[model samples]
Each structure stands twice: as structure tokens, then as C-alpha cells.
Target: MDLPDPQFSEFVTAFLKDRGLPVEDLQFHSLPSDGSKRLFWRLSPQSDTSFVAMENTPTDDFSKRENVAYLMIGRHLFQKDLPVPEIHHFDLANGWFILDDFGDASLQESALPKERRISLYESAIEILFRIQTEGVEGFNTEWCCQTERYDQYVMQRYEANYFRDAFLHKYLGLKKDWPELENPFNHLAATASRADNQFFLHRDFQSRNIMVSAGKIGILDWQGGRLGPLAYDLASLLIDPYTGLSSSERDEIYQHYLRFLNKYDPRQVEPFRKYFPYLAVQRNLQILGAFSFLSKMRGKTFFEDYISPALKSLRHLLEDLKDPQLSPLKEAVHS
Candidate 1:
């Protein structure tokens, strides 16, 4: 029960008091930090009753937007009966909130057998479909933290440029311009931007963000979600470097998602599959970039461990796509 500094403790005490809860008996334990600047603490009041406190330390306007987006999107999803944490209390002015504790059983930490993993992934896919469809009915772009849409600009700037700067330059220290890559990135951005089925895209739909507790899957860290190609999130999940899913497993999960889409919206099946690989390439590159940035710039060295897996995933995607434009990227990655 190592408490935070006195000021942080006082803040939490006052916050709990406002909600008619006594903090004198509560025990607070700091949780491990993620890539984001937010700090998390799990506060336990009883054997079974606990809450997770989140404190957002916004260094600039961008992080501030993320703070607000988390609260707004979280409330919206909870109201829609989505499997997100229930917001207990939030104060936007000070950037702190308490939420229902989903426990520490993230999909990344799950050590389930093959059968259980398949079943859990099936449920996750179903929930993803609902978020893409039902979750978009009343979704407003104004609630998005940064980019309103996962358009070409986002692909070029955030995904491609991020890979170029963070992974290629900063991490790998690759100086070669690799002029051949420009055309591939351009083609990918163009094709991905024109994807037909635009829906709510969970920008970081990886294993770590999916929490599994009591046989139910709960989504977390959705502050960066926005309107984007349906394949973006699907790609993010299946090609997640952390999960290390085999080709067969990835195929099974992808087919499952297709079956669900066909049952609900058959019209989207073809286009979704057509754009999935391209989006996967984009997602993998973004993951590599993010892992590298988090490791080098943010000093979270654990992310460095995932860089090789991310590169491998990217190489596989490029090879499977077999697009001539991607040849240069393939060569560079292989090199």
C-alpha cells in the first residue's frame, strides 16, 4: 500500500470524498506505466471493490485533447453498453478520474490454452464489429483527440512519417533515402484512404489494450479512436506483434470477422478483405514506429523488444501483398 506523494494522495482523498467514499481505509498501489503520459493507480477499498485512478499530465495541447477525449469517448461507450470501464468520477480541470477496475488480466497477459484463446478472440471480434457499426451511429468527430479521420494525411503523417522518423532514422539509424519507398507509401495511402467501409477505428487495438476478466473482454486506452477504414482495427488485432499469432490462427480469426460482417453487412465483406492487407502494412509500420519511439524517446526500453517482431510482421505483409510499389520497402526492411 505504497501511497503516492502527499499532494497526489490529498487529491485522491478529496476526489473520493466528493463521491461520498472514505479514502482513509483505502489502499493505493501504483500500476505500471504505458506509452502514454498518464499515470494509473489501483485503489482498493474492500476485498472485491476497487477502482483505478487515472491522472493525465498534459505537457501540451495534444495531450490535453487526449485527456478530454478519454472522458468523452469512455462515457459514450459506457452508455452504449460497451465493455469499457465505468467512469466513477472525472474532473477535466485537473485531469484525473476514477474508473471501474477491470483487473490486470490484459489479453497480452492471458496464458490460456488454444481453445480458450480462440473463444476469447471470437468474442473480441464480435465486440469489434459492434464498435465499428453501432458505435459509429452517433459518434462525433469533435470528440476525437487529434485527427478527426484516419485519412491519407493520417496515413502519411502519423504512420509513414512516424516510421520514417522514429524507426528508420531514430532507432535503426538508416540514412539511405530509399527513394523507391515513396511510390509505395503513396500507393498505400491512396488505396487505404479510399476504403469503402469507414467506421470507428480503434487506433491501438492490440493485445495489451484488450483486457480479459471473468471470461469477458474489456477494451481500454481508446482515447485515440476515430472514424477510419474498418480494416484498420481488424489488421491491428490480427497482426499484433505481442500476440505472435500463427498464420493459421490469424487466418481463422480473420475469417471469423468476415463471417460476422457477412451476416450483418454482406456488402462490406469484399471491400474489407481487399483493403485489409494494405491496412495491415500501415498498421505494422505504425507499430514499429511507436515501439521504437516509446523505447528511445520515452525511455521505455521494454518496447524495444517488440521492434523485431513488428518488422517481421511488416515484411510478411509486404510479401503477401506482392505489390510492385512495395518492393523498395520490402528490400529496406529485409536489409
Candidate 2:
């Protein structure tokens, strides 16, 4: 793979040389691309220490803001004693980061066909609770690149419309009368918004972003973190089609999460349960929408592989919920 620009090279050289690693002995390896537009590389040397460098040449406004978010939110989480990666050094103006290399054992690390990786997710749940309960202290909404809270407006515009416009209309080429979808979309948004939205939320807290580094869970891709529902992130984890967790397995993990939550905040358990299905369905819609948009619009075909599974999971949850108001959404899904 190609190396970064000269400025990044200069930064890396100085960053390593200051730590006693020679510039001549370094090896650069390109990491696989994910949903993010940022380029990442693993810089290794003869010594035991290796660093993951992120290179983001922002051409637009959002990417620039995202870099700022990554810097600020990362520092906030680290200061709050959360399980996020240690950002050693960064230059958001130029978009470069020197970060600790959390070696490639994700929570989704190749589970068996019948059952998903239970232990990995269970461990992640513990870290997740901390991210919610403890991470909210002194959290500034300004640190969020996107919207500061996961509310009805966010649901309608981002998740619901994203599903209809990107997945159904554009990707599937369905001539959907979106006005007909208004009722079910409103129902979902209204119901989900009733949950407590004061907690710290990692908006994309899926298996891929949850790393297992040195036998401890470390979170990544936190630029999208904000104040949101407690159940929303958990919903994202449970309905993650990438893991291919069976319905039974989802229930088991969910119950475990509830028990864990009860130990800390018993009052939240019932409310969390009440809004979970809506959030799960909402998250699945976002997934299908995101996968479709990323694959069809952005040409990132890796997302296309998960589209079918996500759609299947979305439909299953819609069926289970069986909300009379969601019939229109059910129609859209079936169509």
C-alpha cells in the first residue's frame, strides 16, 4: 500500500524518533477500510511497540468536524476512565493521529455458526454500562460531530428517512410513497424517544468497533458519541446482523444486560425494556439504510454483504413487535 503525505511521514518520524525508534527500521502496513472515510495504517518496528496512525485528508465540512470530535470525545472518555483507545498524539487541523494498536481481536471475531461469541459480548456489556452511566459526567454535546442527542427528529430524518430513501427507494429501486410510511415511522420515533436520553451513547456501538486489546475491552470510532437513550446502544449490539446471533442468544445476552443494569440502576430496567424493541427496529432500519447508502452511493461494497442479513433481522423484529401502527412499515419491508 501507498504511504501517506510527507507531512504525515515527518510527524511519524518525529513521533517514533522521540520514543527511540529509528526512522530506517519502521514498516508500514495498510489496514482494511471500514465504513469510515479515514485511512489507517499500522506502523511497526523491530521493537515491541507498534502504533496505528490515522490519516484523514478532509475535503468536506463534516469530516473536519469529525476529526475534532474524535480528538475531544476521545480525551473526554479517557479522562472519565472509560475503555477507549489511548490517543497518544493528534493534529486535527492536518488530520493525523498516533494511537495505541489494539490488535485485531474484535468482539465479532469469527463466532461459530450455531451460537455467536457470548463471552466477548458479555464483557463488552460491562464496558458499555460504564460508557452510559459514568461517561455522561461532564460530557459536552459540542464534542459531538453530528446531532447531540438521539431524539425523534434524529429518528425521522436520519434513521427512518435513511431507510426509505437510501435502502428502499434508491438501492432497491422501489417506488415508495413515503407519505404512507409516515404513520409507522412516527410511531417508532415517538415510542423510542420516550426512553431516557441523558446517558452517554456510542451511536455505533456494534461488534466491529468493540476491540479486545490485552484481554480488556476497548472502544473505537467514538466520534459519533453523544447523549442518547440507554437502550439504544444495547439495541445496536443485540440486533447486529454481522454477528449472526440467534434469537435465543440475543435474549440471553439481553437478559444479562438487564441484570447488570439492575445492579446499578434498578429504576431504569423496566423503562429500558419498554423502549428496547423500538430502538432495535430503529437501529436495524439505520443499518439497512447505512449499508445500502455506503455500498450504492459510496462504492464501499463490503457493506453490501451485510444488507441481506440486516434486512432479514429488521423484518423479524418488525414481526415480533406487531404494533398496529407499524403496518405501513411492515408493508414497506415486505415490498
Candidate 3:
């Protein structure tokens, strides 16, 4: 057990005391491998005997919003008899708190044969089905209204000399029209605005954020829960860069989600499948740009391993689109 920030642990002890959880000698455990944000653990010899600690970044960061959204959705889901970690205690002032240790079971840790991936994912989808079917409060239009709101800015940022002139043109010796790429972006954004089926979207809802233990799937890292098109979560799951499922497995899960949707709201089928692939295309590009930008500017070069797969997925998806505007950009990327 290690306390990277002593103040946080001190606060944890006091916070647990206030919550009426047993607290004598709280021992902090070091998980050591938190990506994107720093997280730690402190186990108090309390009633539950364990708690996970997380540090909050600035409010502007999407992670912070996700934290808020997770609690909101967790409350709703818990009330509806869903399997979710209980929030032991939280500190809104300094943005540090303790939570239930759902155990050391991750989807990554349990590697069954590829044939079983679909069954596992479908089980996870059932959680989504529960939330979407049962009306959850605290997540509304405001959560999704700003989803593509960052598209134009992201497109413009990459449109500038930042991406093309700096890396693609200079390093990779690739040259192309920056403005032309924006055409698909514009089309996608327009389509996104008109296609509004809002649900409580777990933005990073994938295997990494999902924990499997005690014969149940526990969702974590849901701080970015927002009211977005259900397609967002669906794409994030089916098209996840990690735990990459084969084409057949992905299709299996897709059909499973479709059946779940049909049972709950059959009207979503035509729109879901149609827009899902498009959303996958759009998401892959943004993820590519984001990984590139992070490596290039933010000194997070560890994302290098992710670029090739993202681009490959982008190419695969864009090739499937018949849109003339998208075809050229796809060619430019692959060429």
C-alpha cells in the first residue's frame, strides 16, 4: 500500500469515518497501471474492508464529467436492481473519494476462446438494455447536446497545419487537401444533429471499463455518462480498440443488441444499424486524430501502438461507405 498523495489518504480516512464505515488503520493499495488519469487504492479495516481512491482532474476534462455522470446513472441503476459498485463516500470539495473494490476481475483477465466473446459482450449489453428500457433520470438531452459540438473544433484543429503540415506532410511525406476532409465531417455532423435518439450513454463503455466478478458484469469508468445517441456506446463497445473482436463476433454482438432493442424499442433497428456504421467511421477518425495529437503534442507517445489499428479500422469502415466525398478521403488515407 502506497499513498502518492498523503493528503488524499488522510481525507479518505476522515471521509470514511463520517460515512460510518469502520475505519482504524486504512492501508492504501497501489494499482500502478491507471491510464489517462491517476488512481490509487486504500483499504480500511472497515466493514467492507476495501475502497478504491481516484483523483479528479479539472472540470473541463471529460473525465470529471464522466465521474458525475457515473454517480447519476449508478444511482438510477442501483435503484432498478442492477449490478453496480456502491459509492462508499465522495468528496466534492477536493475531488477525491473512496469506492467499493469490485474485485480484481477484468474482461482482460478472463480470456476465453474467441467464440465466447459474443456471449460475454451480450451479457454486458443486457446492462445497457436495462438502463435504456427502464427510464433513468438525471441523464437528459443536455448530456448529448454537446456530443458532436466538438466535431467542428476538432476538425478545424486537425485541418490546420497542426496535423497535415506538421506530421502527415513533413514526416510521412503525405500531402492532400485539408479542406476536403471536412466535407464528410460536415455531412456527419449534419446527420448527427438530425438523428437524435437520446439515451444514457456510457461513452467509454467497453471491456476495459467493465469488470467481471461474482458471476456479474460491473461497469466502471463511467464518469462521462451523458445523454447521447445510443449509437455512441454501441460503437464504443463493438469497435473497441482494445479486446478487438473478430468481424463475426462483432456481428454476433450487433445482432444481440438489435434483438434487445427490438424487444424494448423496435423502431430503433433501421436507424441503429444505418447510423451505427457511420458513427463507427466518424468515431474511428476522431480516435485516430486524438491518439495522433496526444502523441505529437501532449508527449503521450505511448499511444503509438494504437494509431495503426485505429487507422486500419478507419480504412475498413470508410471503404464500406458509398458516399463519394468519403471515398476520396479514404483513398487519401490508405494511399
Off by over 4 Å in 3: 16-25, 32-35, 42-48, 57-70, 135-177, 296-302
**Backbone clashes counted, model 1:** 0
- Which model is ahead, 2 or 3, in terms of TM-score? 2
- Model 1: per-residue Cα lDDT over 47-123, one tens digit each: 66688998886678887888888988888888889999998777677677889999898887682466677788888
lDDT of 3 at 94: 55
Q: Report the C-alpha lDDT of model 3 over 117-193, residue by residue, as the tens digit.
A: 66677788888776655534544534332252323353335332344454455435566556676676677555653
Candidate 2: deviation at residue 80, Å? Answer: 2.2
Residue pairs with clashing backbones, model 3:
66-223, 66-224, 67-223, 144-227
The TM-score measured for candidate 2 stands at 0.96
Off by over 4 Å in 1: 1-7, 18-20
Question: How many clashes in each structure?
Answer: 0, 0, 4
Cα lDDT over the full model 3? 0.64
Give the whole-model CA lDDT for all candidates, comma-separated. 0.85, 0.88, 0.64
Q: Where does candidate 1 have its weakest 10-residue lDDT segment?
A: 1-10
lDDT of 2 at 93: 80
How far residue 257's Cα lies from its native spot in candidate 3, in Å, is 0.8
